[model samples]
Target: MASAAEQLAANMNFGSFQKASELHKRIWFTILAMVVYRLGTYIPIPGINSAAFAQAFGGQSQGILGMFNMFSGGAVERMAIFALNVMPYISASIIVQLMGTVYPPWEKLRKEGGEAGRKTLNQYTRYLTVLLALFQSGSIAMGLQASPGLVDNPGLFFVISTIVALTGGTMFLMWLGEQITSRGVGNGVSLIIFAGIVAGLPRGVWQMFEMTRTGALSAFAMFAIMGIAVAVIFAIVFVERSQRRLLVQYPKRQVGNRMFGGDTSFLPLKINTAGVIPPIFASSLLLLPATVMGFLANANLPAWAQWVPGMVGQLQHGQPAFMVAYGLLIVFFCFFYTSIVFNPDDTAENLRKYGGFLPGIRPGKRTAEYLDYVLTRLTVIGAAYITLVCLLPEALIGFYKAPFYLGGTSILIVVTVTMDTVAQIQSHLLAHQYEGLIKKSKLRGGGRGR
Candidate 1:
């Protein structure tokens, strides 16, 4: 039976792809857009010593900047035009979303003002991104000076040039992401990150092979790393696809002896409601404190300052403390952001207005309470799933010196985005199929009547 079901699925998938010309067009556009994005990553910004910059980055690969570089596809390492990527924009978005929850004015705007408020918020986020880019660019410039040969001019010219270029580059990438979302498949920002991970894969693989060849890494260790990566991916897929289904019942309304409206449906609550945001936010926030401490410690400082870099360095890939903290943060943000995004009260009210009620529950407050209960349980399971997926394999990878892209967050993003895009395609195909059936039915009816 299992083999037969697999065969059936394979056939259905083949048919879907075979006739999905529209889907093909959308996918090709997405690919082209990603290619353009990857190309932009390679275009270096002006006024920096490329060689020294390379060496500095090479030395700092085990630090917080490694995560940033991975996101940017080595753009940050090279100080390319897209060096900043869309991270600052993403950071601004999270900040604005959090503020909208706490501040009454922003909350009102979110609920009532709608599109206009959204536009205002988007503009504000852009301005915030610019500020963040400026700050980052300045810090990077100062860090460059610390490595004596990293800046070609090593003065005002280099600083001004880098600040302008990195800021413009980040803005350009934001625009590109918008274009992809409007004109292509999948999310633009997500696709950009996906492209970076893919581009860096070959290099990562080569480095691992080199380590093995040099006998620094063992054959068993290499096999273990590969096995762990596969397992993590499978775990991510399972958790991401998992959901809780609540049965909703609609009562029959009788008019003129005709019975109607008796139906049942399911409201699916995803296991991982917070998605990739929690881990991404955790990484960004965690990196900030470590980065600042390292910077200050670089100055005329105490012995503790020297220990700071080494401690942070250990935390970068797979140290126990880092893993524990990373997992806990993922779990915290999962619940935190889920609370902000999903409101059971509003949902239950809407269901009541629509004449729908959950099984074994009242229409309003009781239903809301039920939903809240279910969601909380699901969120706990989800947070545990996310934390495990993120931390454990990453710990193992650290044992083997594997790349960060193999971590849980990357797997989550890749799997979630792939699922979403494929679902969109399937919806389009289903709609087309229904339209074709309707047209055939109409033609047969007209012929019979004639």
Candidate 2:
């Protein structure tokens, strides 16, 4: 059945796309939203010396700061309004999710409140995002002022304005993501981050070509980088689509000479259920402190704050400490976020409710335990895959001086987002085809159609 569906999807042509008017509307809306986001990345903040700010952040581009800038769509380098990006909102959502685990009230709200409850929690996340954005933006404001020539007007007004602009930009991005999720294609937040990382692709490729032309980068090295990129993309495609299918059988039933049930299906569990979230969460969390301290390092401050920047600086890109931390965080979030999103007990209960039973397992407690066991094993492998894929690019950057945007995490995100978005588009096309078939059936019955 899945193969047949895949074949049909592959056969989708221009006519199919033209017929899918609603899908086209969603696609266009998504493109317009993304374009608006890209424009925001170029809009500089008030009272900041663009050239000086660029020099300051540009020097740290090879390290953790570079990764941050990539996610921000080069907003940090320009001191743009969107320099903070959608990170604070993501971080806040992560916090809210973590809280849902430990805090009983929050958990009840998530589990029992339904859509309204989810909306409430989302409201809480937005509020938290505002607070986080304020703190980070303020730190940036203070840092820019302290840095030589970065702030054209270094005073309370400049700091206040910087905080306001940065915070407003983040809020707007949060709203934009919500809009995309509701009325556009793909996940809004993920698409925004994807756009940011990809915006630099053209520039990075150009830089490499320029280097080869200048005899600075050997042709062999550039080709090797391309090879590595292609290999990584292929690996992502293979693993992402890989799934474990558990056979489920339904007992035969008959009523009024009509046979029902007696069919088998597979419950497909994805190898990486967490998607690209773990790396995004881990990187966003790590960057918050690094960004604050990196900026604070140069601030005209007393002796105590000096240690903060020094400690963060030690975890620069290519450092052993950095790799270890990144790997550990990825592993932790992989299991953590996966658990939050998927619950074996719930799945088992639903299966039992519907008279579905996995082969060789009881439908209730045993099924739940078995599902959990399988998920645990799969998650272990998934964590390793994610950690390896994301860290490989970082390692490459550290050793070969590759563009930061080409890192494993960046590539993983790009590939994952691309796959997900394509899947969504295909699903829309499938729905459109289904509608066409239904219309044909109605017309065959000589029914009037609108």
lDDT of each: 0.77, 0.89
lDDT of 1 by residue, 1-450 (tens): 355334434445566666767767877888887888888888887767788778767766755677778878888777788877888777777788778889898888877777998888778788888888788777766666655666677788877887888888888888888887877776787778778877887887787888888998898888887787788778877877888889999999999989999888789999989877788777766664555444443444466556766766656677767777788888888998898779999999999998999878989999999999999999999898888777776777777766767666666666777777777766666655555568999999999999
Q: What is the TM-score of each candidate against the true structure?
A: 0.89, 0.95
Q: For model 2, what is the alpha-carbon lDDT of residue 448?
A: 50
lDDT of 2 by residue, 63-132 (tens): 7888888999999888789999999999999999999888999999988889998999999999999999
Indicate which candidate wins on TM-score.
2
The lDDT, on a scale of 0 to 1, for candidate 2 is 0.89
Clashing pairs in 2: 393-408
Please give the range of 10 consecutive residues that has the lowest summed lDDT in model 2: 441-450
Q: Which candidate ranks first by lDDT, i.e. highest?
A: 2
- What candidate 2 gets wrong by more than 4 Å, as runs, is 1-11, 212-220, 446-450
